[model samples]
Target: MQSIAVSMNLLEFAEPVLIWLALFFFVKSGRVKRFPMMTTYLAVRAASSVILELILNLQRFASVSDTLQNSIYFYTYWAFYISAAISIFFVIREVFLHVSEPVPGIQRFGMLAFNWVAVISGIIAISAALPLKGLGAGMVSIGFQVMRCVSILELCLLAFLALFIHSLGRSFRSLAFGIALGFGLQAGMELITSLIAARSSYLDSSMNIVLQVAITIVLGGWIVYFLSPEPHAEREAITLPVSSPLIRWNEIANALGHSTPHVVVGQSSATFLQDVEKVVDKILTKNSISVNS
Candidate 1:
């Protein structure tokens, strides 16, 4: 069972590694500027993994009290959450950047408000982990409670972001895909945790590796494909004329099969200014005019 668990973890790591490689190539090729945010998220995830290993060693190799274990778990978990929260914010920003319509005047203001909320949440997560002396007992402290409450508010904000992005479905296909998978894994993991009534401080950290690997695969592949030089070049080369040029007017007016008025220059007498004036005079006098000139 132990060997199986390690093997499973190894297999899970492959997907994320592939994702990282894909995104890495894209970043190197200048395919995506947003790669940095996603890359940083993965780095934080790697750090979380290291922290998880240390915690496990402390439990297995060294003697640590359950309370201390729980405390360490809370700190590491909060760190993961903070990192994840920031990552989600960047993802949402990417979605907005590709919004089908220009950012609304209201959304421009909302973005500023959202940034402040993100900052406040990051600070709160750090504060929550700052137990009195880094013990679980400190979590019941006033500061931690307030921070937790704020974290809940941040959670609500994510819902709003989801709805906002949903309005831009046509343009944000890649981001929408990543969010669907990332959030789906998150929800499934949380549901499993609650249903099983089992809590492992280390469990979430390990799962994050899996989630990161999955994200790396899906988002990384998408960025590479969509941001490839060829596709970008094609997009840049597309010339959608806002106004028809003189050449277009000539083509439409003179081109065969076009419905522009065809004036028979020499054959039609109505094509001349002199002919038009003579016709008008004739109409006024109720008489005819001879074309002598």
Candidate 2:
């Protein structure tokens, strides 16, 4: 029994610290903006793991029965599960923002709606599990049901997010790969858990932690790959064609007062026509328009 307790303690405590320490150093070597999203995920995970470890330590010290300790462990695990889900959602959103392309306004709004739904569902699950300060209607049944529902919503959101990533095309290579792999693992785990009974959901719990760590590590790699400044490309790029005639048109328009007439001052009709043609050509070139005429 003591050995069993020790094993649980080590799993809950040492594992998270080691994983997070790896995460901490990996992130410290990269850009600051990337740190907030990934670090937030790791931080919540660490807090939840430590809390679970303390709960287990208390149970061991007080010599609680295995059944009671298991019950406590189950509820605590759900709280952490919901938190991790929310964190993943945030990481996905951050990736979208980092891509710097405009998503459809409706799609953007859809992501927001999904975020709110996840938050509300997670709150409900947490409420059901812990009630007020760990004094709830003690059982894993309700929490499990709520989590199943959350997982379904997450599944749908994952699909929408996948489409969003797909629309980004090739520039999102690292981000798209990470997102698809993470969502695939997460969705697979959730489906398995939802299909199986709670007590026998070993793969669900174990795979979730594994997927999260993998996703976090991959996300960190993606950040380093993408977010690092593109100094070489910036230096090598051609300057925009600001000197093109289309931009000069704007200056010409400003120079010509609102009441300006269309007469050419000291030119023959053929020369005037030629000047207009040149102006039009300049306008088209400057504006990046292909004028067939």
Candidate 3:
């Protein structure tokens, strides 16, 4: 028990440090502008971890009352939780946009689809949380449901990238793929831990530790990916096959919400009218000659 507590404390301390390191590398790699939401997410996570740690320490050593401490912690934790949850959607979107950057049409269409998915997921989460008792409990439930939805979306995004990697002409080693991979791993761990916790209350403590370890691994991986130099080949343009489904879908998506080209009779209107009148007069004269014959 002492060992487990010590390990958990160490993990808690290491997490924020690792997060800060990863954030530093992310900016150093010059990806901050490209993935602003992801940068924001990392900042939020790091700040929340530090604040929550301070709250925990205050509860142990400070003169604060239990009620006051609980209130502070509750509001602080929930506020950050909500912020992180919201930022994650945008983070996922950043990854998607980066992956589809080669195809503007697909990027636009995917963003629209992603927006609809987000709306539907929120509706479902709210519906699921409606049955819970009390406002506080319901809000917590909604957060969990919303995160679960995001997890599923992350997994789907990872799968889409994997399955269409060739079609999209993207390398697996690209930064975009790295971000998706990390999120997918984190999401998968959350889902598995959630299932395990649901199945047995006794494993909840173990699962928490496991989840933290998984997160630590993912953050470390992200740090390495951001710090390492990318391959020169990755920068070269890729040519997609004509028969690729990605190309076909991109074409179809491009065709959507666009009007057919129309000829505009602007300054040439008078000349066009004169030519049309001459052709009509000639046709009328030919018809009149035929009728007389």
Candidate 4:
């Protein structure tokens, strides 16, 4: 038990360091403009970690009442958690846009679909939480469900990149792909850990440590990706063949939500009536000639 506590403490200390390092690389890579949401996520997470750690230290040493400390910690932790979750949604969106950048039409259409998915996921999450007992419990349940939904989305995004990488002419080594890969791995670990924790309380402490380790590894991977020299050639605009399915779909998506232009009459009302009379006279003449024949 002592060893496990020590390990947990070490990880808690290590996580903020790893996160700060990752943030430094992320900014150094100059991807802050490209992935602002991801930047926000990292910043929020790092700040939250520091604040939470400070609170813990205070609880250990400060003369504050236990109830007051617990309340402050509870509210602060959940607030940060909720903020992180919201930031993650935007991070996923930014990555998706980057992946689909070469195809504007698909990116536009995909965003619409993405919005619908988010709405549906929120609805489902809220519905799942409705059965919980207290308001606080329900809110917490909603947060968990929302995170689970986002995790599933992360996995889906990774799968999409994996399956369509060749068709999209994107290399697996690209930063966008790396981001997806890291998040996908973390998401998978989170989902699995949650499931196991639900099944057995005995493993909760061990699983918490494992989850922390996985998160650190993900942060490390992000740092490596930012530090690595990306191939400039891959940055060139990809030209998909006109016959390619992606292109075809892009065209179809572009065509959606657009209506053909309505015809307009440039002629004055008198001219329009004259032309109508002329057409009517011609048709009548043709009928009279046929009758005579």
Candidate 5:
């Protein structure tokens, strides 16, 4: 137990440090302008991590009554989980935009789909959370359930983007990818802790320490990733004709599991991408011309 407390203390101290360092480098990277949603999400996450640590410190060593300590603990629990859920949602949306921004039509589609995913998934997660009612249910237990739901959604978002990396011209943002990877690792750790808490009393006592170490490692990884420069964006070399059928492109995109959003237009809104072969031909021709000239 003494070792556990030491581990927790070390982890809590390191969290805000990692977060602030990552944020400093994130801003220095000039990512805020291009990824506003992700920047906002990171700010919220860093603040909440600090606040929750403060609350936990008060809960632990403050000379407060049991009632007051309990109140503080409950407040801290909900504050962390709620903020985490919201941050994950924002990161998913940010990644979607980053992955779709090269194509205007695809960006619109991804944004619309992201909105749908975030809203509908939130409702479902809340509905799942509702069943863990009663004072005896415990906030940690309930919050863990919510985290599981959020984890499933986070993984789904990552899976969607990862599977279509070849189809989409744009790549994931460095910040967005870091957040997702960190969150996924934390979620996995929590899920493991939850299972241990259910099955083994001994393991349950040390589960919080396990979670803390996992958090530290994940955040430390983020600090490193964010400080380093991201790769140059994938080139979009082939320009399609101006008069291609926008609706047909939309259909083709959907058929190819790439969404094209519906927008109001009289006869046109977005032009279509050329066929893969034609696009390759056009790019080769342009490169040949440049080389010859």
Candidate 6:
């Protein structure tokens, strides 16, 4: 236990350092401008680690069953946890955009699919939390579980993109690898930590140590990926003529309740619909001219 304490202290101290460095590079590399959600994620990590460290110190010294300490713990934990969760959700979407940037159609479709994934995952998380409501650490458990699933999804998304487009360019792969490293480990560690703690009601310092180490590795990886020379992607020109069938299929997909323009918070249905309309009109007009000729 003495060794455990020393290690945990070391990791806890290191977390903020790594986070600050990660934040620095995130902005320095102009990633903050390109991927605002990821920038927010790094900022949250730095802030949350600092806040959580303070909270832990207070809780350890305070007498058990102290109401004020408990209240502070709950409120602060939930605040950071929720913020991190939301930021990660958007980060995943943004990373997908980066990977699929060359393919506009795929980008649009991926965005649509990601909306459904977010909605379903959120509903599942809320339902899971329902039973654990009122438990002191229930919200944290819920947040971790939801994040674990999302992180796994992120890994799969990256894997699929890599597999399908073996040459998505160097810059794209670099970003994708950085994201996968962070979230892939996150998903695995959170699955173990969240499940074990929720079942036993015991929060182990060892888990905290592991979490910090994983995060440090991820932050360091980000720094390295950013510093390396960005490989230029050879993008193929895509100019497939859209047909009436393609438009009908899109309309059918929308009608089948597969669309979430309204359900996806912050997504503008008006702009999305307008974009779709323009594309469809252009396609139909081109087809009409070709047929007439």
Which is the leading candidate under TM-score? Answer: 4
TM-score attained by model 2 = 0.48
Candidate 1 residues 1-293, lDDT tens each? 57657756776656546545544555565535544565565566556656766785687876889889877777776657555555656655554443422334334555666678667765665676565574544444533444344434434444544564433332223433344444444544444554444466656555555544544455555554545444232223223233424235434434544466778766664558988898888786664333332
lDDT by residue for model 5 (1-293), tens: 78777878888788778777777777887777766766776787778777766766774666787787667767676767667666676776676666655456666766777677667766765566567776435455556555566687677666766665545543454555666677777878877888888898778658988888898898788777777676665333323344545445655555665566889868544345545667889999999999999
Ten contiguous residues minimizing lDDT sum, candidate 5: 233-242
User: What TM-score goes with each of the models?
Assistant: 0.44, 0.48, 0.80, 0.81, 0.65, 0.67
lDDT value for model 1: 0.51
| lDDT preference between candidates 5 and 6, better one | 6
Global local distance difference test of model 5 = 0.68
Sort order, TM-score high to low: 4, 3, 6, 5, 2, 1
Model 4 C-alpha lDDT per residue in residues 1-293, reported as the tens digit of each score: 99999999998889899999989889998888878999999999999988988887785687998788777778788778878887888888998887787678989977997899789978987888788887667667778877877888899999999998767878888888988999999999998998899999999999999999999899989999999977885577777777778988888878888897899969666777789999999999999999999
lDDT of 6 by residue, 1-293 (tens): 89888877787677688778878877887666668888898889888878777776785776656677668878787878777878888888887786665455556777888888888878887777777757555677677667766777767765665564444433344666667557766667766876776767656666677776776677777778766655544233323335434344444544564555666568565787799999999999999999999
List the pairs of residues colliding in candidate 6.
none
Clashes of 5: 0
lDDT (0 to 1) per candidate: 0.51, 0.55, 0.86, 0.86, 0.68, 0.70
Name the runs in model 1 displaced over 4 angstroms: 2-7, 34-36, 43-85, 135-172, 175-293
Output candidate 6 Cα RMSD: 16.1
Question: What lDDT is reached at residue 255 by model 1?
Answer: 51
Pick out the ten consecutive residues of candidate 2 with the lowest summed lDDT.
231-240
Q: Candidate 3 lDDT, tens digit per residue, 101-172?
A: 667898898899889988998898789878888766767877887787788888999999899876778878
Q: RMSD in Å for candidate 5, one decimal?
A: 17.7
Order by lDDT, highest first: 4, 3, 6, 5, 2, 1
* Candidate with the larger TM-score of 1 and 3: 3
Instruction: Count backbone clashes in candidate 1.
Output: 3
List the RMSD of every prediction in angstroms: 16.0, 16.5, 7.1, 5.9, 17.7, 16.1
Q: Which ten residues in a row have the lowest lDDT in candidate 1?
A: 231-240
Displacement of the residue 275 alpha carbon in candidate 5, Å: 49
Residue 252, model 5: Cα distance from true site in angstroms: 2.4
